[model samples]
Target chain A: MRLPYLLAGLSVAAVYLVLLHVGEGRQREAEEHAKQGHVTASYAQLGKAYALYHEGHWPLLDTRNRHFAYDLGIVPKGYAIKQEMEKDHAPQAVLFGKLGRHAALSLVPLVDFRNYFYLGFAVTTEEEGLALAKALRSGAALDRDIKVAQGTGTLGSSTLYRLHDDIVETLVMDGVLARQDLTLPGRIPVIVERPRDGYAWVVFLDMHVEHLRYPGPFPLTSKFVDTLESDAL
Target chain B: MLHERYDWLDQARGFVVLLLIVSMPTSEYAGDLLTGDPVLGPPMLNHGYEYFDGDPAITTFIDSGQALFLLVMGFVGYTAFTSRLRKRGKGAAFWYCARRVGVLYALASIDCVLLELATSGKPKWGDFFYNGTFAMIALGTLCAFLSIVVIPNADRRMLFSVGLIMLHSLLYAFPFFDHHTWYDNILALPKFPFGTLGMCAMAIAGSSFGQWHAMDPDNPRTGFRKRIVPVSTAAFVAAYCMDWVQPAQHHDSNAAMLLQAMYIGGFMLMIFFAFGEVGFRFPLLSSLGRNLLLMFALGGLFIGIYLDCFPKEFLLQSPYLALLLGGLAPIVILSCVAVFLDRRGIMVRA
Candidate 1:
């Protein structure tokens, strides 16, 4: 009876010790998993920076690079680029443009395309708009058979145009000429600000882009120009 | 028959038992109210002042009830030990005493219902109703015991008592089966059907022992002493062993283990002393144990209400006078009420 009791006591003690050790080990493993998750999040942020660089849109590329660098504590001295960029337009708008550009560029590498093209035209004057169109046609980077369409006059203003094709699309209006949807040459986007307060500013605006239609005569039509002023207001 | 004995010892014992039973559930709430720190939360440095800024009465009630219950239990235990012991006929008298307990239970039930209605449904019906039911059941148990000891039909007595025991066990375990509150499943019934079974078993067990004593009066103390000492020692040992094993979970740590062991050990000792040693009978002390149901119910309500009202400091103070008063006030009030009813012969039956 004494031996049996002794043996049972020893066995239970051994089991408890083993359980303690196992519990400690599990706790350590959980800590390691948490560390791994943090590292993975940091890597994702770095990947975003690399994509920004390839787009050649230095304004956006510089800003993202600096933000990540600051977060990682690698940059002892903060970069003054954000202060400079804010002097021109809203920081949010700049961020949105970069994100949109990056999304468009992601589509490029998937397709077996060699070159990507973008076009812009101001609709205020027919002559200036046609001149820009001629310039796009003549450019070595653009495809020869670029598709086009046009918008209709909804209000007093007449100049609104929508354009699209197998290779490229354009929406031109007064003070604006938007490249409707063109993939960047690589899996990254070029973030360039439209000339501030210039006639080209409308090219970056959403109203002209939304009115852009497809399956028409020119990549952009006279109707696109007619709808421009009404859409802008 | 009006028996104006007014035994302070008995009344005090009852008061303490009632306080303990009632306070068990309220202790958790009181801890929360006084500390302002919930059992599971960050410790509250300012006590429950922030949480219970508007409610002081509830805090006072809890503190007073806890302190008073502890005092009464301690006081009664001491008084019963020093006082002269009473010797009575074991078999028939035990049954008769148990049945008489039902009247006290009925009065307790009326008090419970009044308290429940006064509390505006804050306290659970189970807490109050279970007390009355347990008392009634205790009466039935006494009857069963008397039948076994006085009647000669052994087979019939054994069968009936066995059935009652099984039925009572089933009722106790009903909560596990239904996976619901014990009150709704067991206490909610009009006759406290499950508890009655336990009462019947107790009665039978009491009767069996009583009859054995009656048959063999020579050195009756020897037989009881032989069983009591060994069983008490084993229970104590078991409690100690349980305390030695520390579970891994923080909630199941050494402190909890020890507390649980002590509780079990205390219960075992109480049982052994109450039934095994007949010559050591103290009516006042045994009555407290016998009326555990009623006392527990009243204690629960008082504790619940007290915790709802007071802060921890009132109960945890150094001199302990505040704690003592806080705990004792409710029991004293309730006991006074019980005494008045006892005098009037207005016994309650659940």
Candidate 2:
């Protein structure tokens, strides 16, 4: 009979309506903050430094300075980049996290919305940041994407490192070891770079995530790359 | 002889296979969560589109696919068992499947062990005996085989399915399941496969569907839309609206299971009817469905093999292009393999 199906349908509908009401506020807040102006504003106070690397390695840039053609989808609050750091670091957990280790890591979700980019910074005691840098230089767990080989970038010795078949690339600065795990899976074309200083960065482009399952050529490609290039922290 | 090409089943399975393959790169199994022991095999190992970074839509979709897989498993299992019963008799079918399920269990155990060795240097006892989907499949088959053979009455079988799931649902009411108690790991042993009442319930529902399909004189193709469209639409709407479930983040939660059923059931009805005309028109998906196990294994290895062997730096320059290609890698390889297997009549049922 249709009884089981009907009851299931009604129960499901009722439950969902209640849940939608509860989550509406969070959804609206996420949409409001996701505005392009709100996102780029985070770097406004930092002056032009956020845009240029080492005073002038790359020119200052602004991205998505306008509308989000189709709002991708709201990511639940406080969801971390554990997928990148945790899964990637599972093999190296012994050497990475605890107090006296190779490097201390800080993974940040750029905006509260968390669709686009996740930034990772590894700070080491003393010159160990450089030591960690050297270890990264070894390319321990990553594969080199030969299509865009080292020194292929317009910038200083810029190279790309990726796990095979992966979309996100470790955009190694001057060939410094980039964070292998600082990735936004499914959203490729994002950059994971480490500059001359001990600081390492992950600039994820939300365009890939937002535009997937929709239309062609993925608009905003240039905007994302420019933002990453400008903010190659 | 292979069952007259059940176009819907083939497409359904191919769809499941496609979902699994795509979800792999996008989702990473929670190894940290898998540590110690788990009740439902590390939250289904599917975090969804953002590499398990909590993409709600994709996560729900994946969950529904998995649940439908269980349902299909029961339907197909019952169909196969009944067909075999006519040829081999009821007792023979029963024992034969017992042995068959044993083999499946052995393979599942080996898979778990190998996965552990691959990811973590050391393999645990649980890896060999209990882990991931193998146990779920093997153990679930055994449970269904027993239920079908013993409960001959259809009405009773339906009640049994409902009762079994309700009993399973009680495990959650216990705060013990929620925490990291020492016993939680110990309890996970029995929990493999038939341990979760929800899983058993799903299998029963599937078997019932299969039984119905076999007996019904009405053309399934024509009757499908009339019977399924409304139910499926309702299920989907209800499932999409599910927010309290946090379906993606917590795999073992009941919400995840319910969402999976609704999504899978609804999507399946829509897809089976919509793509029926065109889906099988492509030879690759059909044959891949036939030789699914092999293609699935091959797909899982697509990335791993690439990581170990090739080193392409150019992919990063154009991430979207790389992503587009990455999605295509499995399809291309599967198509090639499907073509090879289809031509040769090679099929791996398990």
Candidate 3:
């Protein structure tokens, strides 16, 4: 009677030990897979934007001294408004805004841990935007060490690419275009405004990407475009 | 006609009743757990799964005191099956047992009414009081019927039964004075112990009748074996059927009412079979059964501590697993101790 009881006890203990070990192994594997996927996707998008800037046609801006001004539309004075855009234009602005927001939002969360930055600019001609878009698609114009990927979306027929952090910063500081808000870190201001009925010229401190629509004039300095090409080599 | 020999039918009936009483607590606990509510009072901890979260009124009124009664009656039945005496009258011991249980029922019912009044017409009154009263009455009724049928030599047993009642009443009045104060938090604990003592006395009285049945020449094994199968089967079937009825609508639903009836019936049957089969040999469990007052007080205290302090996640997450281990752990430990004690022939007697 005693021997049978002792045997039963030992068998139960062995079964318990085996179950604990198997459960722990499965938990570790799940954690590792989730972390690796997040990092890889972020790095790929940055590389594409850098390539487009190197080869695209840059827009020239109409300026007063160093500052370029672009008019969006007229607003009625003394009216308290919840949204900046008017009703007819609100839908178009929202669609375009989301594209730009997505690019900015994605890079924002990763900014502290990795090297990433946001670049905003506008161009005058569809041809110039297409030229910039094609250049972004080409790998040769981007830095040898960095990889490039680009995305295009319509916001009332304008396009933008989220650029790689290092490339965007290098072009802005090298004096390719006259700079505003230079005191702030990681702030590269490019004002895109509509002049008359024709189109808007967007100015960039660096070369533009063809995949993005150049709806108007862009204020880009020749020197910044030169540095981008030079950096690619 | 007075029989010089014991009649197995009487012994078997007492055994069935005892088993019914012993197993009542498990069913009550299971029912509360299934409904996701406490069957007793407020749980010791926040978000505790030990007690059902639903209205305690029904549980208190119907389940708790009833379970206690079943537990007590089960012990008494066991004691009656074990005693050695001649079966002078077939129905006398059974009537004696019934009367003794009736006393307990009356006391418990009054306790229930007092509790209900104290709580002031709350729905919880039903759970707290009525259920308890029902349990007492049901067990008392069953014992009354069984004692009248089986045990004739119950006069001496009646004295012990009265003693058991007094002891229980005393415990209820002064719980702190009990030897195991740590476990006697509930007012019911003292009553339960006394009930167990009464059962032992009843069993001792019933045993004398059992001896006569064993000696009867017309049918020796007929009384014990014949009764065991049907009674056990009836208990199993009744308990199974009762499992389907929802307790919440026990008052409204005829099915629920029927289920409770069956449960009581089934319990009594199981007790009868268990004692007849054991033949007073399992003195340890019998002793435990006999000392209902002490065992219940201590058991309740231990159960309270387990529910209050033991981790709920470990016990309730998988109830089947928890129950399997919970039931087995104690038995194994006891068996080991029993083995050690048995080697020295130092049996623990009630």
Tens-digit per-residue lDDT, B79-135, candidate 1: 121121223334434444544455545554655666557767554345344434434
Q: Which candidate is the best by TM-score?
A: 2
Q: Model 2: how far is A82 from its true place, Å?
A: 19
Q: Report the poorest 10 consecutive residues by lDDT, candidate 2 chain B.
A: B179-188
Q: How high is each candidate's TM-score? A: 0.32, 0.51, 0.27
lDDT of 1 at B43: 22
Model 2 lDDT tens row, B233-321 = 65456445444433332244243355457446545745764677565444455676776656665666565555333223444356564
lDDT-wise, the better of 1 and 2 is 2
Q: What is the lDDT of candidate 2?
A: 0.46
After the best TM-score superposition of candidate 2, give how far the Cα of residue A141 lies from its true spot, in angstroms.
45
DockQ of 3: 0.01
Candidate 3: tens digits of C-alpha lDDT, residues A45-150? 2323333564532222111211121111211111111334454443222322233124211111221211211122322233333334344444323212222222
Error of 1 at B215 (Å): 6.4
RMSD of each: 22.8, 19.4, 28.4
Which portions of model 1 miss their true places by more than 4 Å? A1-233, B1-102, B117-176, B180-196, B206-220, B226-309, B313-322, B327-350
> TM-score of model 2's chain A, to 2 decimals?
0.20
What is the Cα-based lDDT of residue A2 in candidate 1?
Answer: 100
